[model samples]
Target: MQDYLELFFNLIKQPIIQAVLCVIGSILAAKIADWIIGRVLSNLANRTSSTIDDNIIQILHRPIYYSILFIGLGISVKAFSLPEVLSFVLLGLFKTIAVIIWSFALFQSFMHFITWYGRQGKKDNVF
Candidate 1:
């Protein structure tokens, strides 16, 4: 058991393994940002009254935000083979994108939900 454990640790110490882990870590970070944005969007949508805006916001923000962030992260992580400073710079940009995505997703959700419910109110009170 000790021998096997040592062998596993040694393999993880390789440069290639580190590179792979960095890429996987970046992807996992992207997924986490995705989840956080979705949750924030849900909360904002529930709070606001404009269902149309909320829906439209969601429609506009959902895929584009995630796609851009994820693609950017993937491209940035691919730069791991570059200089050390470049890798760190790429990570910084990736984090910025994650923040942007999170903020926009929340904004879009609140806007679209407000639009949706606001229209619903108009219909309901028209009687």
Candidate 2:
């Protein structure tokens, strides 16, 4: 039993196994996040009159999901102990992707708010 346990630990310590576990954990986390965003927060947003909450939820959903995925991928790659140059390249790529995802979400949310404000302005005869 002790030998079997030691063997199991050794097998799990392999880089590939670590990477796979990281990826799986990240995916499961992303799914749970998505479900909460899609169901719970969305329901709460529906109860409110302001569109801000709704816009925020919408804008954040995909970025948050993909960010989790990227983080997982990054961890998985790091586990492989790749060449320094390759590791840095992957890190840079993930950073760029995260920035793009966040920027796009911000832009989308800003546009949504602007549109909502415009409608409000029209309703108030301010424009």
Candidate 3:
């Protein structure tokens, strides 16, 4: 039974340090994204009113949440080491994340366009 259990987990040979490194990378990436979002919102708010600040905050929030989730998943992957079982799942996860990021980018662009159009409409009304 012990041999069988060992055989079950044999694939996950990566060291704790490697997994830790990956987690650290994910965390750093999240923090960097946070700072970027903050700075961008600050700059935009300076340029205009506070209306767009809320949208920027909302857009930035989910990526930070998902980055930490991804780190948890990476740590678990290191422990499970069942690549054969998890390969497809991991692939799907990556694709899902990519889609989410793309969606956020597209949504942000749309919001920016709307704001610009609204501002232009106000100008036209004033003239």
What are the per-residue Cα lDDT tens digits for candidate 1 across 36-121?
66667656786876455446545555555555556655554554466778877877776777677777776777776766667777
lDDT of 3 at 73: 61
TM-score for each of the candidates = 0.46, 0.89, 0.53
What is the TM-score (0 to 1) of candidate 1? 0.46
| Candidate 3 residue spans exceeding 4 A from truth | 1-14, 40-81, 125-127
Could you give the C-alpha RMSD of every candidate to the true structure, in order shown? 6.7, 1.6, 8.0
Q: After superposition, how far is residue 27 of candidate 3 from its true place, in Å?
A: 1.0
Q: Which stretches of candidate 1 lie over 4 Å from their true place?
A: 1-5, 25-84
Full candidate order by TM-score, most accurate first: 2, 3, 1
Say which candidate scores most in TM-score.
2
Candidate 3 scores a C-alpha RMSD against the true structure in Å of 8.0
Q: Could you give candidate 3's per-residue lDDT for residues 1-127 as a string of tens digits?
A: 9998786566335555456556667777777776766777556666766455566665656666576657656565655455765856884686589578858866886787688778878978953
Worst 10 residues of 1 by lDDT: 50-59
